[model samples]
Target: MTKRNTKAKQLILNLLKAAKSALSQDILQAQLGDAVDRVTIYRVLNSFLEDGVVHKIVGDDGKQYFACCKNCSDKKYQHNHFHFRCISCGKIECLPNEVEVKLPKAYRTLNFNGVVSGYCSNC
Candidate 1:
């Protein structure tokens, strides 16, 4: 299904595209401030996830963060790189390098969420 480009969707897309690191719903809410409602934001995010416009990252604190997808599609969604979480700033970033994981025979790999925690270069 072709998703209509709404104002809310454009706003969220711009925010995600300009973000250096993954952003949480709270951050988006604070940034948007009264421009968009919480429920609308949630729906927009869910649609973006389904459309492969963004990818979700679950932090160590159990908060969901979002970032623009570099290589994803509606048919096949996959994140082959690792997410780096800064220990000092608690910021999550999607690493550009792709990771290859080897599994035992007869085992099938599904979703991958490999996170590496450490102090970023700026920290």
Candidate 2:
């Protein structure tokens, strides 16, 4: 399925695609220049998140960052990937490989929460 393109959405999408890694709102705004506003950015982020066109990488600094989907044509992000955070520089990098999360056979009946965070080589 394909989505109808809008100017603001395209701008936000391009910003994510060009980012080195996950980008904070300030960085995105700076990168986007005067083309959009914070509210618009927030809305676009939320919409993209719902549509799976982007993914959020929460940083230890208590800020949410965003990354682009490499396969953007699919309108969905592969959920099995991991994101690496640099402790010293506070940069977030997406792991090239997928990380599998499987519950134990005995615990499969229970609901669980999972999140993985750690320092990367850049730290």
Candidate 3:
């Protein structure tokens, strides 16, 4: 299904595109202020996820974070990269390198979400 280009969606997309690291819903809500409602933001985020415009990452703190997808589509999602979380700053970022894991002969890999937590370079 085709989704409309609403102002709230555009704002959320712009914020995700401009973010250097993955952002949580709370963070996005705080950044958006009174312009967008929480329910609207949740709906837009779900739409983005369905459209493959963004990918979700689980933070070390157990919070769900969203980041812009570089090479993803509605059918296929190529997210073999690892996510890094800064212990000092509590920031989550998707690393550029693709992760390669060798599985057993009969094992088939589906979705992978690897998180590495440590002090970021800035810390």
lDDT for each of the candidates?
Answer: 0.87, 0.74, 0.89
Winner by lDDT between candidate 3 and candidate 1: 3
Cα TM-score per model: 0.88, 0.72, 0.88
Those runs of model 1 whose alpha carbons end farther than 4 Å from true positions after fitting are: 104-106
Runs in model 2 lying further than 4 Å from the true structure: 1-4, 72-78, 104-123
Candidate 1 structure quality by residue, lDDT tens digits, 5-121: 999888888999999999999899999999999999989998888778888888887888989887575548568788999989988998888888888999877778878899999
Clashes of each: 0, 0, 0
| C-alpha RMSD in Å of predicted model 1 compared with the true structure | 1.8
Alpha-carbon deviation at 27 in model 3, angstroms: 0.5
lDDT of 2: 0.74
Q: What tens digits encode model 2's per-residue C-alpha lDDT throughout 1-123? A: 786678989988987888788888888889888898998899889888878787777766678888876665665334566676776676787777765667677653221112346665665
Query: Best-fitting candidate, measured by lDDT?
Result: 3
